[model samples]
Target: MADINEPVDVLIIGGGASGAAVAWSLAETKMRIVCLEQGDWIKNEDFPSTGRDWEARQFGDFAISPNRRKLAADYPINEDDSPIKVANFNGVGGGTILYAGHFPRFHPSDFRVKTLDGVADDWPIDYATLEPFFELNDKMTGVAALEGDPAYPPKPAVMPPLPLGRSGEVIGEAMNKLGWHWWPSDAAINTQEYEGRAPCINLGHCGSGCAQGAKATTDGTYWPEAIRARVEVRHRCRVRRIETNEDDMATGAFYVDPDGVERFQPAEIVIVACNGIGTPRLLLNSASERFPDGLCNSSGMLGKNLMFHPYSQVRGHVDEKLEGYMGPRIGTWSMQFYETDPERDFKRGYCYQFSRGYGPVATAVNGMADGIIPWGAGHHDAFGRMFDHSLGMLAICEDLPEEINRVTIDPDLCDSDGIPAPKITYRLSENSKRMLEHSVARGKEILQAAGARDITSKTIFPAAGWHLMGTARMGTDPKTSVVNEWGRSHDVRNLFIVDGSVFVTSGGVNPTSTIQAIALYVADQIKNRIYELFD
Candidate 1:
């Protein structure tokens, strides 16, 4: 037996990035909207930066991996079968709470991968269709960047770019010497006072929740506005499954409240904004007589085509003290190899996102782990040499859609609520391997140009699974994708998805900006065709 709640006009699951955007966008409709979040609001005072052991907390309570964090709101993901582990935050702001705020939009060529590279499937909608939404999202998020980047098409910055510190200046000069395209990163962290949030004061680690409210997490941006517009967000409610009627249309969802009691929330329309793995897990768990496979899985593509942006890191140590840890984690990026070239070994290409070095504790811990810093007497001297003298770049490689690399329900692993957990079955493609190699070689060249010493490289960074996408892809054909071009389900018309799960192809850059843009675009379509939305 379950307590049935009053039916609302719209019910949104997951109050993260895309969910927050959708709720805010649809608020103008004046329809009853309720958003269910698994986690509660995290106060700014509780952020890691406010504590003495901030760096230590990054590996513990605020760890990106939910398994390690072991928070009550988090559901364990069985990623033992894959090389790359899952990194996410289960909260009102979701992964954005732990992100470095390096926001980048997908290139125009990203939407036409098959046409340009003859590798992955092309997205049903092009970049132009979502350009306005991208601009809107940028304004709302207060993206900070420089103008006149040769890589992108005339996208203005919401604020002046974050100051290019010593590391950024060095890297930019190196790229200039190499004649590679480099630009200021479109960061979500506030560079100046905007939207009532204070500017970033170089608080060092932006990944562990910005205590100064500088970072543009959705909980701080959209959620407040949506709440003011009468959107009700219920925290600490974990959805077990979506419930559908006999006609195979989503009626509501069955969720466990904070009290551990089952409750049914009915809605005229249901929108799933859970991330890639979570969306698939919920859909698979919502199996009914009509949907023997899963809800909206008539195409059998609900849990297929999982893509994780393979990440690589290359670091170099300079003689001059760069003070790398004194600024935002990321500063500039290079799109020199973003587009595929006939001469390259890989079909698609990647982006070089330059990042500053770690804090004091991180540098010490990593140095010991890498055998750079020995125990006892030699420790202080070695740590002194590396503390603020290092700079690095992450090679964010594009991951093609592969049906074999999927998210499946783990038979043995279950969450605290007894709901089955998601298991990742993924492997790096040969193209990804070659792409990583090319990027690493180029990265080393740039570091050498900058007169760096002791350059080290790490390929396939095991814990770099921050970007989860493509499990429930959107496309024109029902046989290939779970959702239609408008993000509506092919099997269930009234059900929609607005998350990384709806991505058709995983681009080389971070997907947060593009994900929010797509959500806003879907919300616009729904608003325009409100009467025919269910048709």
Candidate 2:
């Protein structure tokens, strides 16, 4: 491989959303930054959408879950104890390569879940502190939406919102009739060709990787600027552990290069940007004699408090042909129930994402499997009814952190590199169940209002662990948290975390935007305190 013994001023692991953003932000300081990505860079041509069998390809190579995709660079996750399956990517762009690009910001109230609802612990930092960074990230990523969303505070202008396609228009009309809060969604996809990227062509399979290069995958957005700024991004480099010095401070990382050669890259400072699960996995695997439990896990919360948004989905089939497969998959959503309500039985709330349903093959298969369409004589008729008439709503339920729900090392399972895989032990809390029940009922009502002849809802989507968070929470108390407000490790002075693992609470919406904003904020924090960071 390349020069493994090179000294770097800053070493970042995982070139995903947060890693790329942090690299770009720190690149402004002209620091020697290097990022190690477990997977290779995903070229736009690698997307399967250009072929006729793209729909079937999703079941194999483009599958969201690493276990299903089984790419050489992916690691195995032991999800036997969890109801929701783990879904993530291992490429240079990370999950952004497969995310739907829904860029909704976390509500202000999300930071104070304990102070307001007496549930999870409150974050050390508030929403106001992150607002500026959010705006900066929004501009950098080309958010496509409007201001004046009642659900959120005032913000900068965005590109014109995605068109409310036939499905969205119908659902919006229903919500308006019902007097519920609804708005066009904020998306990371470019609408007017910002930052040398082409506008979205309404690619149908955004979740399977945006082949058009319109969606703001980090490979297209941040990494380009970071490399231009002289940041070295090493792909297919799987970091197994962080090597600490005699003082128990991070000094370097040990990883395996693409050719299965072990290498060491020394650094003055180390930033772990691997997402929620991957971050903790690396830390736990880096156990040393000075810190036997795990590096930076002096609080004994290294893999505790695992949180994934409990998600549910409902699909409706109407009589009209809506061309549901022609546009973006999850463009428009409603936050009417995003905030807390005294009348609701649950403590927190959930958001509803209204969008066109899956492709014809997926819809038909799901319909036939669920017995919604009979197999004998009624198959053709049922398939015909659902082919172009399917619309769906996803309910992202807020997940409260509990010590019992956690990510631990699987003694029996390991990745290709022989590192202990992450074992998730999670179950939905009562509040989450109640919130999902309410959401499903409301979703059915909205669908019925849209003239849907048949409707179906599932309490939990089997493979909906996209938003992993809170494995290593942030707080001011060193005894209760792993990192400080600025993502600096309490136990290791030179170590920092800039990923979803530092989340205090899981919000009711997508976590990618918040993850990036926090990364940028942490990068600024490190930049301002570079000389005195470890003091």
Candidate 3:
């Protein structure tokens, strides 16, 4: 028996990026909204950047992989079967806590992949429908970028772009020499003071959590406003499953509190803002007598079509003593191969996200791993040369949805709360392999053109499973999708999803900005149809 709580108008799960956006968007309605988060809020001082061992903490407490962190809030993910392991954060701001803050909007053509490229399914909603929401989200998050980039349509910037440091200058000149398109990356990091947050002070490791409050994580951006609007966010409450009524409607959810007690939260509507992998895990765990195959999984698409941006990296050292390890990881990007081409070996192309070099510890560790630095006396000399002179680019390859790659509940694995853990079974597609080859070749060319020597490449960066998407995809047809265009579950009328799980196609760019936009759009739709929301 579980303790019953007061019913609310709406219940939101996972108070990360999408969850924060949805809560803030729906705050105007004055509904009794409550959000459940597994992890507690992280203090700014507790962030690794404030400490001396900041670089080492990235491989330990703040490591992106939940399995390595194994915190109380984190559930174990069985990624032994997959090559690219999952990288996520279970805290209030989710992955944004450790993200590079590289925000990029999906190209308009990204929405019509199937229509134009004759591969993958097109999104139920287009970039046009979500444009206003994107703009609104950018304003709220204080996105910094330069306008009039040839890669995307005219988009507004709330602040000036982050300065393109030495690495960006080198990459920019290299791309220009090759006649490729390069642009300052749209970043959620503050370049100037905005909304009470200070500007970035050239902090080297933005991924280990920004102590300066410069990066736009949801906890700093939307959560404050939402909290002021009376949206209740309950921390350390790990939801075990969503509870459903006999009518096949979502009533609320069953969760474990901080004191380790099972409780039931009743609500008029339920919205799942868990990311792609987490969303499917929750849905599949919420099985009932009437819905034995898992809630709203009649189409058998609940945990299928798992997609990750298969990533590859090409790095090299230049002769110049460049300050390449002292700013945001991604300063600029090349969209030269973002769209599809008839002459390409693969269908969809990839974006070249040029990044600064790593910190001292990271450089030494990576250099040793790649056999670039020896273990003895020569190690010091090798480390010193590669410390500040290295530059790299990640190939953010577009991973098309495939039914074979999926998230399944592990038969033997469970989390701290005894919830079944998610098992990832994924493989790099043939198209992705070919795309990586092309990306590596192009990346090497750019590095060589920049007078870089000792160039190295990783065809498949195994730990680069940062972008998780496409399991519970959105579409018009119920037979082919889990949710409708507006993010409502096909079977459960009062249930909605506003996370990357609703993504129909994984674009070549990072999904956080787009994920928040979709969440805001879904919130807008829920507000508009409040009267007939259950219909």
Predicted model with the maximum lDDT: 1
lDDT of each: 0.93, 0.90, 0.93
Cα deviation of 47, candidate 1, in Å: 0.3
Q: Candidate 2 deviates by what RMSD?
A: 1.3
lDDT by residue (164-279, candidate 3, tens digit) is 98788999999999999999999999999999999999887899899998999999999999999999999999999998888999999999999999999999999998898999
Q: Is candidate 1 or candidate 3 better by lDDT?
A: 1
Between which residue pairs do clashes occur in model 3? none
lDDT of 2 by residue, 308-355 (tens): 998898888988888668778876888888888998898978898887
* C-alpha root-mean-square deviation, each candidate: 0.8, 1.3, 0.7
What is the Å distance of residue 231 in model 3 from its true position?
0.3
Superposition TM-score, candidate 1 onto the true structure: 0.99
Give the Cα-based TM-score of candidate 3 against the true structure.
Answer: 0.99
In terms of lDDT, model 3 sits at 0.93
Query: Which is the winner by TM-score between candidate 2 and candidate 3?
Result: 3
Which 10 residues in a row give candidate 3 its minimum summed lDDT? 321-330
